[model samples]
Target chain A: MLNVEKIRADFDVLNPESPAKAPVYLDSACMSLKPRQVVEAMNDYYANYPACAGRSSHKLGDKVTKKVKKARELVTEFINAKSDDEIIFTRNTTEGINLLANSLGLQKGDIVLISDKEHNSNLVPWLRLRDKIGIVVRICPTNEDGTFNLDNFSQLVSGAKLVSVVHTSNLDGVTNPAKEIIKIAHQAGALVALDAAQSIPHKKVDVRDLDVDFLAFSGHKMLGPTGTGVFYGKLELLEKLSPFLVGGDTVESTSYDSYKMLPAPEKFEAGLQDYAGIIGLGEAVKYLSQFDFKYIAEHEFKLNAYITNELQKIPKIKIIGPEDPKLRSGIVNFYIDGTDMHKFAVMLDEMAGIEIRSGRHCVHSWFENKKIYNSARVSLYLYNMMEDAETFITNLKKILEIL
Target chain B: MPCIVALIVFGIMGIFSASHRALAEEAFGCVFKRITFRPCNTGFAEKIKGKILSKLLVRSAFLAKMVNRHYEILSWIFFILMVGSTIWVGRGVYNFYVYGSCNGLNESGFCAFDPSGENNKVTSVGDDSSCGITQQSEQNVTLENINLSGFPAINTGSKDTVVFVGCYACDYSRRAYPDIKKLVENKKSNYIFAHYPAKGDTMFLGEAGYCVQKEYPEKFWEFNDYLFTADKDYVLNKSNLDEILSKFGFDVKKISDCANSAETKTAVQDQTTELKKTNLYGTPTIFINGKAFVGPKPYRVYRSAINKFIFF
Candidate 1:
């Protein structure tokens, strides 16, 4: 089991004994709070050896190159990829999705399949590709309970060139069956890509085990620095794809008219990278490796189950996903019939410093399709205690009574 | 509605703060959208409401609920109040420029700009004085039909008249006299000097002024200038007054003889009675082009009264 109290001590923001009340941060699914270790790792790079990696042969440069290589290796191990060369550093999940959308060499009339509940980061890139290249984009609808409908997805993947979808719906935290979906898609001869931004933080996502052809997740979502993400591909698959953004270190040699490109990861990484952020991401992975995913999942589910039960007691509250808290994972998304969810979220913030995500959670297409305006989402993490859930429920009930 | 108020407030506050400037820009966009009859869904109002309710909710959830329920109505109320106060401040600024008091001529009320009411202060006429003025009515105070024939006068032929009724010994008048002198000399108007003893044992100075004007009319202005600018102790000393008269090329014996006469005393008293007809309430009362300025004014006030566009 995870020692949550000791884990809380690692984050300064969770200092409960301070003069001011520490924020009951239930918005971890949006962006996780960085621990002292992750911050210090970034500080070490900027303070001690701030230099460009792979370009310079000097001592500082060699130090940066070694640190960057170690970070890449950590990322590979984190995702259980075949080699470090399969991993490419990106700004965020959006950039990684965009790189795949542009570089995957899909031609006219080639079909790209997505789920009904994909985040805009996973949805927009494919839509843009469809628009620019005259390719067909298909939506595989979810079940009535907001869970992935594998039967419908299997039917939709028949002639699809690529099946890119969110692994876990950030909307309601209903994680899809990525392994089964990948097996079915591979049988249909369609490449499978999973947007694992939400899933990678709380659970173990081994790319080799799932055999997902492509996977992208953000560092900030997993307690790393913002503007850092990792996109992993099958080694041969990454090497075959063209570089979407080519510049500076992406090339081996350049002339006025022509240039020879570097290998997979280097060819994709353009200009100067976020070296500090990459180093911090590695430290974040090391920190996560200490904890077992089973315990993290259990801790989150305990809090989510409490929140879900308490929220169900409140009149007019309708949870977005399935009634079962086990399926919803860490996120407990709900909306009152006539109340403004944004205002409700803000009230929670003001009343008890309970921070939660509001609005569509970047899943506007789902909301628009369902005719739902917005929802307030409480996403739990391993560090969240039962006290945080009780406080959130108490404050929410007080707000409801007053209103 | 909140955007309108935010636009004005944040636009002004934007000058000193970059964060406010960003809000002002947002308010500008929101207000622009609102004026075009489109829905103001820019979230500016919601953001502001959230900020306000966030603070309010911590203090009192019931109050926050009430505010949230009536947010639009409250925004309208605030908008109206902001506009009303803006107009009120604008009028106060105008009145301060024109009348030297935020509450118009000679009215001593609280002015935000001149908080101490220094611009409207005067050396008051004492209760025991025989100037024969009992009531203070600023609106009723005017220069119509008041005879100016027997007063110490200069610039007689000019159309624009400046009548200054003051005391030589009064501090406010002494402070005002130099600026009034410069204005009168610069404008070259029909300037009349009426000496009413509003303070001190200065009735004798009034008789001395009457005598000096009568006996040596050519040096009367220079003599008046000297008395206003001179030390109060020196001006009050009878022998010093004679010495100054002498310096102005006046015969000390003749001026002293005229000053001591009962006739000259009656003349100064009659001058006071004539000045009182203008409802004279205080010392340093100046009339520029029929506009009765009841206290010592800045030179620009006097000059602007004449030109109505005095930049200097």
Candidate 2:
């Protein structure tokens, strides 16, 4: 089994001396706290070797350039990219999605299929493309328990120009069968882009094994620094795609009239990149790499199962999403009847120092479809233990009793 | 001889009589020359003399009135022209101060106050070749004729122009890039991304800078697509300091050499100090024509500022 206490100790933000007073931190789905190693890696970049990358022959610049390249390699290995050239660094998942929306050549009469459970980042761009290019965007509905309706998805993917699906729902933590989706989409002769923002951190993802055309994830959600993310595409596919940005480092040569661009990853990266954040992300991946995924998954599953069982005993509380532990990942989203989610979240924080996310969580369409205004979500990660879950359950019982 | 003397005497008497009657009419009824003059006391000869004298006096008075009226009209015209010219000059000065120079070359330019000197200088900070404003060392007194800090003034219906200047390597800039892209996509009246690399930030700054223009040509067009991108290092590092320019077509060598020269550096430093004195805080900071607004503000702030500028 993984050592929870050791992992918790690695994260300095969990200490009581921290200015924010060390929250219980059950909101890893939103953003994860940085480990000391990740923070130090970033600090070292600014403290000692800070320089512009890929420009100067100076020692500092060369060092930073190597660091950025190494970070790219790490990400390539992490995601099982065909080559390092297939990985492009971006600010976050939103940018990655926008990049695809701009470059993917969706024309009039083109059909783009998406799941109903997509985040706004995934939904809005396709919707915008639909408006711009007159493409048809078909939303595949999910089952009541938050699992993908494969039959409907299969029907929708046929004759579609593109199929974009969220690998895991951030709202409810139900994992979608992305492999099957990709297979069906390819059969239909459509390109596939996977929103792996939730999946990459919680579990192992091998893009080559999965054979998806494109995948996107953020650094912060996986214990990396903010303002860093990765976009992985198949090598051939990446080579086929045009870059969304163009500038100094991306081109091989240029004149007043025209210019020739570099291939793939370099072309996609157009400006001075965030070296420090990418370095921190490398450390974050390295730190996480030491953990046993099976143990991490099992530990979180046990605690989440315990929390779900206890929450069921409370009156007027209805859990949203799959009730089965096997169906859900580490998130538990629920609402108490007659209790405003915001008010409930505040009381939980004030009474117990338990941090949770409330409201639609940037997936307003899903909540709107369900006819629910908002819900409170308490997500768990590797740092959480059974004791923390017990403390939460006990506090929640008291809250329900008072209400 | 007796007749001639009598005639001259009669003429003087007639003139005096007319004058006296005119004064009496003004004093009583406010009408001149309407009161009846005493008929010539002599006969036909005395009547002709009185008529001739009366005609000459009336003609002279009418001429004097016309001259006075002519002078009044000329004075009114001159006053109107003076007021109009004053307003036109004031507006022209304000526009030059706020939006650089409107006139071609040397005749019109920014009116900047020299911080180091006692007197303000009307420096030609635009494309005035004859002004001897050639590129100089930073230590030189001549200033580069562009206001690098000002946002482009765009009037697109009700939208205000918000310019974001950043290098690709900056973490904050990366985070802000997508938002800037969205602003461009939304077609807000005035939104531009001005890509300026921080000193030594090289890598993606060039490539990403070009990609922004290549991928989103419409948005890039909106931004004028001119700034440092990843490939500018050659231009940035060139010894000649004039060869390396941005894909957006800004001469990087010229800008860099100018910026690094002692004079421009001093001016930049002084301008920074002045900005601090004015309490301007932080970048991603914005201005609606030099009126500062702190930023990373939401889309609403941009929209509101644009609305105010457009409507008012």
Lowest lDDT block of 10, candidate 1 chain A: A337-346
* Model 1 lDDT per residue over B1-312, tens place: 888988989999999999999999999999999889888766677667766787887788889889888988998998899989999898888788877777776777888877776666676676654332322555566889998899877888998899888888777778889988888889899899988788768888888889888887888888898889988889988667767877877888888899899999888898888888887778778998888887766676788788846454
Best by DockQ: 1
lDDT for A291 in candidate 1 is 92
Off by over 4 Å in 2: A18-21, B1-312
lDDT of 2 by residue, B263-311 (tens): 5545444433433343222223344433333223334334444454532
DockQ for candidate 1: 0.38
lDDT of 1 by residue, A1-403 (tens): 9899899999988885758888999999999999999999999999999999999999999999999999999989988998999999999999998889999999999999999999999998888877898889999999999999999999999999999999988888999999999999999999999999999998999999999999999999999999999988898999889987989999999999999999989999999999999999999999998999999999999999999999888768999999999998799999876556877777778768899988888999998898887789999988899999999998888777666
Q: Give the number of the best model, judged by lDDT.
A: 1
Best by TM-score: 1
Candidate 2 lDDT tens digits, A333-397: 89866445764565567666778887788899987887886788888899987777887887666
Q: What is the lDDT of residue A375 in candidate 2?
A: 85
Error of 2 at B259 (Å): 92
Question: Model 1: which docking level applies?
Answer: acceptable
Candidate DockQ values, in order, are 0.38, 0.00
